[model samples]
Target: MTDRLKDFIENNADGFNDLEPSQDSWNKIAARIGHSEKVRNKKLRYISIVSAACIAGIAAFIIFFGKPQNQTDNFAEIPEVLEAEAYYTSQINMKKEQVYQMAGNFPELKNEMEVDLAELDTIMVELKKDLNDNVSNSEVVEAMIQNYRMKLMILEEIKSFLETKTDDQKNTTSYEL
Candidate 1:
């Protein structure tokens, strides 16, 4: 079989040599290669342009809006509001501790108090944001101070209620004993 294949190939070698590719076919192949190369170059150029645009957009955003603001700096502009906030915050903390201590046996009451305080805190945060946006706006600063005062009021009310309930419980227990 090998000898037969070798003889067949030797006899057909001249026919194979005579069958050369046409000039038009060679030109078509070259054109396809060139077209694909052009498409690749176009794709590369588009990708680079988009990347540059994205980088420039990000840089502009950082340059325009990345300034850091100090929390104390805003409050420093209004010393009275700052002092009021500090006083009310300390008072609220003290009252909260007292209420929590008295409410150790009343989980539901404690939870309710916490929820009320949290709502006030949320409002205070919004007021603070407004104040920071316009430090010179006395209305916003007043609102912020009022928020603190309201928080202190709520804490005081809770503390007073708990103390009254504690006193009533002590009196009832003493009478029972």
Candidate 2:
């Protein structure tokens, strides 16, 4: 039994030696696989870094320059209208004599005022048309503003007159009472 054990040990020892790879060969194979894995990892890392950098750069560009430029460009393209000025001027130019003549008499003056208001409505429609046609023109924008301003002024004047008339009526009524 001992001799058989010794023979088995000696045979298996040489068998294991034959099966074992040389140290240098094993090292080369290990190094090749390791190097390949390292290269793959490096390439992946580089791609990831480049992608991140590209995204960051685009974001930075949009944040720093794109949004404000777009806003300014949009605003710049919109025509400026001086509505208040136009309304005021138009109101001042309204002919009181014409209004009175249209009234036919004192009682009819209210009707005349209404008719005059209709004229203003016509003027507003024309101004809106002009604005639509010449939206790109600065002069047109200014004219529209002036026209609107005049209209507003006319409205204010009418409002004042109505208030005055109302006050007068209240005073007369109180005196009669």
Which structure among the candidates has the greatest lDDT? Answer: 1
Q: Residue 55 CA error for candidate 2 (Å)?
A: 55
Q: Positional deviation of 169 in candidate 2, in angstroms?
A: 1.7
Clash number for each model: 0, 15
Candidates' C-alpha lDDT: 0.62, 0.47
Q: Which sections of candidate 1 miss by over 4 Å?
A: 1-76
lDDT of 2 by residue, 1-177 (tens): 379978888878866576756669966785777644345435434443443344344333433443222122232235333444444555544644444433342454355345544554455454444444443334334444544444444445444544555667669967995
Candidate 2 lDDT for residue 39: 53
Clashing pairs in 1: none
User: Tens digit of lDDT per residue, candidate 1, span 12-115?
Assistant: 99876887677699667756776443454354344434433443343334335434444455653567877877788888898888888888977866775676
**Could you estimate the TM-score for every candidate?**
0.54, 0.34
